[model samples]
Target chain A: MALEMLSPALILLLAAVLIGLLKGHARTAVVLVAPLLTLWAVWQIPDGVQGTVKFLSYYIEPVEGSPLRRLFATVFAIMVFVGGLYAYRVARWYELAAAFAYAAGAVGVCFAGDLITLFLYWELMALFSTIVVWCGGTPAARAAGIRYAIMHLLGGVVLKVGIEGVVVGTGSIQIQPMLATDFSTWMILIGILINAAAPPVSAWLADAYPESSSTGSVFLSAFTTKTAVLALILLFPGEPVLVGVGLFMVMYGIIYALLENDIRRILAYSIVNQVGFMVCAVGIGTQMALNGAAAHAFAHIIYKALLFMSAGVVIYRTGKSKCTELGGLFRTMPLTTVCGIVGALAISSFPLTSGFTTKSMISQAAVDENLVWVYMLLTAASAGVFLHAGIKFPWFVFFQRDSGLRPKDAPWNMGLSMILFAGLCILLGVFPELLYPLLPYPVDYVPYTAGKVLFYLQLLLFSGLAFFVLLPLMKRTETISLDTDWLWRRAAPALIGLIERLLGSLGELVARGRVRVQRFSQRIAVRYLGQPHTADREERGVFARSWPIGTTALWIAGLLSAYVLLYYL
Target chain B: MANQDEPLHWLVRPATIRKLWIGLSIVLAAVVLAQTVVYIKGYFGVDAWFGFGAVYGFVCCMLMVLVAKLLGLVLKRPQDYYDDPDKDTGHGQDAGQKMSGTEERGNGA
Candidate 1:
């Protein structure tokens, strides 16, 4: 209770703001110190830190503790530290502030005890992450940031509705498993799926991430979707639909990543692909599968960050992000080249890397479930990952034809951060037990079986072979790939334009009809009033002019005679 | 003038095979060390495990390099691949004018 008295997230958030108040190395020191402090606070969260406080009729539980939560929160904290290191030299103090706030939101999500707490942290993550994207300070970044915000806010609204429905119907706000057959639960699933960059709106990630600043993309790669993965693992484990959706995302990411020419966009697609594995594991819902999802999320954040850092180094040194403008830079930047290759291999699930240990569990689970088709697709996607991100990224940026540009190696801070992440990727891979114990379940699953390792090697190596064999099809171009988001970004806008045109014509016709009616009414009024002789005759005929003295007496006599005649008849 | 015509610009030349061999050797050594650590942890301390690990790593690295070369073929584009030639015509002529100005400056100097 006393620990709850001081919100650790708010403390880090405020510290970040204060850090923004400082300048120079002092700013960097403060930025670096905040995550360390936040990490210490996070480590201090005792097991089962759950309680409820009443807000009117609503009871809110803000702290939930489990190994899964701890795993995600720990990685989020590590990301902050590494991101701070990567960003300290180049990013503005405000951007650092936003990054810390965003990290705090992610950590908050990890410990969120109830739906309300989850939604609160979820929306906070969305808000600060958008600010991080906008901090790129480019017109493109600003537009992408707006689109990102719109998508996230839409996700938040759907999530809020679901949370409210669950609370109203169930009378409890505790975060727990729910079945998909229920309407409220389905809404919640959809809300979280959107954040996970699931289809139909997944374009937001690729659209926004590439537009972020060089440093911003590194931080951007860490939090938003991983948090959604954590939420799904917690709430909707064992849902069959997720397996299908996850496979779609996996292939979707690979094909689109194959099509992308921007270095950051390729990495963004890979994020979706990696998260797809985790989502599938959550769908499996077995103990090993859940652990796989959790472990994969942990490894994903590190390796993805490494990949982004490498891309960031390239962009920072050259001021170019497109793969076409970059090539043959390894001659100048060997450290960056090495770091990128480490990340690439790790992401491709090479036999001795972090991705190999974590991603295999999900595939193993698919096999365990006897889902032959899903397993085969996942195997193909594993190879495709190497083709699109693992090979395409580094090959284009570092080892392609000489572009005659000789940029210096990445700055010391950037190189150091990359090395740290590279080491982490290898550390987790070689010693899976270190990460395995940190998963939510017991550590019974082994990732180093000979059959599994050899299978992965053959699959990934063959994919590598295919990449070499099909190099002509993967050429870089300036054109953006049309994604599901095109439905809203392009098609929706065109539809709106067409509707506006139709309404404009209809409105003109209505106005013309009103004018005609007004003219007709005026003509009738003039015809009735303008004829003076007819008007006078009509007035007299109504007994207005003849009812005077003699006219009134004659009328009275005539009326009396008529009455007598009628009576006699 | 001799230095200018040396044709040994680091940016334009591929890395020597010697350097590639050294780098490969270092990566193999790291993988062996990693396997040794794994073996010592009571997991599978088989004889010649490090050797196996090294060979495995070397093969993977070669495969990755081959993949990288192939990807380059597929993904590589000309520096100006995205630039529109039609739009660049006017700018190209302006650049020509600037080149002439620079040449005049060179002569004047």
Candidate 2:
């Protein structure tokens, strides 16, 4: 296949390969330019399957275009560009390279016209994001990266199995929306849910992301779960099971994040929480709902990356990550503080932020569908989100009881990246028109109606009040909450050890019994085969002694007489 | 580290914090009161009641915190929980089942 027609993802992929070889300005040039070129390529693809090619026996569409595809790809490319801006100065070369490769996979997934192509790109992301986690350059990162890789690879295998099943069953590789009603489709949904950080398997996100390098986490945050959401939108739209899964994730995130101490882990849990919204929207499956999912994904990437960037700067400066270890940073780092607050507000969907414009659409979808339970739960989750992430995060990390930490503001590049995303957050909020048209479907709902604004305002503001009133209860402890990862990291290994011990003891018992039986058999043999009267100390047979022949003769005579007497009787 | 006696950053200053709290409370109250003029159009009946957003938001956060606190009892572990794992594992940590004869065995056997 020609490289040019391969996909826009190739540009970034090729740049990723080249980045390791280049140095200084040349490397910087590639990092900065590649994503933009990809962006251009993304916009150039027109709607529908742009081209089709045969792979072995199956026809595969490597490049396809739709508003949804373009929208997701555009944000991904933008993320790489901005992420490069944020990390180029501070991050290691390998990290930057791995991040680019990981992003290339996400972009590839976006434009993939068939499940085969999507699965290939999905594995590519799984491979490189693991490397990004390892680039954290700590023991924790090493272990977490292994775990992250294992989970994604497992998820990848599940996905591949599902896709194979579907292709075999349907005799096609085309991407089409279907419900998870059968085995293959269920496997496909489950595989996607794992990547989406659904409950039970969701701990991997909170486990791995925080353990990655500051910059690595930013890139890690954007791709994996969001891409899973996209795949869900494409493959399993309107699957009702996702709504409950999403609700669980939403509540799970708030609770875990509220109990968390590490700054990045909090954000990571919230990633699951926010993706929950998109997953639920996909379950809703109406055009407006899908649009909500898409738009929310886009907005989430910006604000989340912005939040991570701010946190990254703080970690970089002070070399601390726990909420308890950080505070009063705003005293010196005004820019990071403001940027973080912007992200915080945006995440909370405050009246004029990107989150406000985007996330509310999901609730609107529920309202339109007359899903009263879903709507109410989503509204409550909105308030819950504001409590944990919007207020709790910034409050503890930037403004709470001073930790006597006075770190400088973010370096210029990091600061610039923050400013860029922070600006986008407000820009999209003020003029959601900037994003709405890019959505997969028409956006009929208005975000800024007075009543809606007042409602959200009250919800978020009173939640902020709840945060303060319950401030004592929100104590930051140096404790980690157990997650499903613990099942493997601790429980599985311990269970294996326990089984081994039991087997070892059982083996010892069997061996002892065998010895006892052997001794008893030996005694019986001695009693029957040996002459006990030969000597007091000798329990051995007398056949080997000098009188052996006489003893044998007497025994033979005694046996003959006994046989004759028995015959007579 | 800055001295404890020094004036706190204005943002965290007690007076500033107190005033900010009051101001934010007023804003919260104002939003709830705005419901009188604007229709929230709740899909659920209970959601349309007076100050539903405010009350619900506060209650949800409180309940969430309470739930988390309760869960913390069972789920919370030291940050180093997985780091060392355990030294004994399943070997000698258990008592009594250890074979007395096994310990007595000579190196030759």
**Every model's Cα RMSD, please?**
8.5, 8.0
For model 1, how does the per-residue alpha-carbon lDDT over A145-180 read when each residue is reduced to its tens digit? Answer: 888999999999998888888988989888888768
* TM-score for the A-chain in each candidate structure: 0.92, 0.93
The single-chain TM-score for chain B of candidate 1 is: 0.38
- What TM-score does the A-chain of candidate 1 achieve? 0.92
Task: Write out the backbone clash pairs for model 2.
Answer: none
> What does the lDDT read for residue A85 in candidate 1?
95
Could you tell me the TM-score of candidate 2?
Answer: 0.90
Cα deviation at A258, candidate 1, in Å, is 0.3
The CAPRI class of candidate 2 is acceptable
lDDT of 2 by residue, A16-105 (tens): 988999999999999999999999999988898866788799988998889999999999999999999999988999999999999999
